[model samples]
Target: MSDDGRQPDDPLSRFLHGETGALVFVREVLTSVLAVALVGLLLFAVSGVWPPMVAVESGSMEPHMERGDLVFITEPDRFTPEFAHGDTGIVTYETGAAEAYTTFGEPGSVIVYHPPGSGGSPIIHRARFHVQEGENWVDRANPDYLPATSCEGVPACPAPYDGFITKGDANAEYDQVSGIAPVVKSEWVHGVARVRVPYLGYVRLVFSEAVLVQIDGGADGVVPAVGGERVSVTGSERTTTTGVVGSASPTLATGSAHGTPTATA
Candidate 1:
């Protein structure tokens, strides 16, 4: 006990009983902030990725990964699977199916990647396969996922430079075919989703909605395109900006819709 009859060496006890109301409130706020910071640091240390978690915002990846799920992600290079796509450390659904590898209830890794030419948010989807530059990948793609019979009819066929073909689990068309995104380059990937915690992501989503309401006055308008062009997206129309890879406007109309920056699921 100190001269004031409080436990002199116990900070928690001091916080609980010895502090004034205003001081205690301040301490509570600071302590909560510090606790959150520590948890974030720990997650970063374990995952080797900054802002290691993402919130799911759409049903594009439904049944396997649903909206409002908090997904923990890691650097692609960490925990490399035996059959990862080269040194990029990503296993496509094709490779994973063959090797019996699986993640997030599917036969491949779920990744958070920046859509090649879009600008809204990073997409969370499965890597279906890898295509080499000029490789006419149309034949290799799943027939069910193909909208066209020939490579010429597909936007990203003959492989527009080597990259992965991505798709949402529940969406009817491939992201490339539907203009959600072009082929995803490994460099555009932010992280590989490793674990999912249900319902926690809604907290982030609620805050995001509040911010958007403030910024855009609650109007859900088309997201601006790269290079300052305004894009109007209709169902399945491919959008291509000058000197930019082709896709839907960065709103990502197909896959995992609207990942927030640092990104969503």
Candidate 2:
């Protein structure tokens, strides 16, 4: 008999000593459930559906967001979609292909498209311009004329007086392939980038450039070739200009004349 008066080989004693399988099974089940819940929460945070996204690529938004930058993006909402011309943020698209055309910003993302003659899908660039009322304006690139009705059929088409265009500061011309009157709809915008965690976007930038190089077939030779894979440099920048929203007139600024200095948070 044990000192506590229980039998040395009692059923309860054996179970406590790992002789029974029920406890082990129960523990494994509980652990699995907890792990699944934790993963679900993580997905929600990173998807930008809750608040924002982390930067994963670099191109025109370089210097501002190097590879590995952590950007906090705000959830997309009706009120948040009204972008002030020149506001920068992360922009999310409804489709996987769309992600290729948008930039990740804290609380939002920016959309940039390819130039008229470039043959490829439109890409998202930093927000360099904004429209208020009916007049077109430029905020971060070269001065140019823009109309209010640019976004006529694109997703999240802002109602009369609630739309804006985005472009890369490094580009020479506006994106015409996405349509001359491409409008940014409220549904398409995620939110404005308010904070930036530098070096968090480095991985994203490397991945984006690598993918672009593969798509472009090593055009610039920036990407080195692997056994079966090839890499190249993709430097194409998309520009969006024109449009009106709110009460102020849109103005154009020269890209070469003035560049928006990179800001770090």
40-66, model 1: which lDDT tens digit per residue?
Answer: 567667767555666565556767776
TM-score of 2: 0.38
List ranges where model 1 is wrong by over 4 Å.
1-17, 210-265
- lDDT (CA) for every model shown? 0.60, 0.31
Model 2's C-alpha root-mean-square deviation from the true structure amounts to: 15.0
Best candidate, TM-score: 1
TM per prediction: 0.76, 0.38
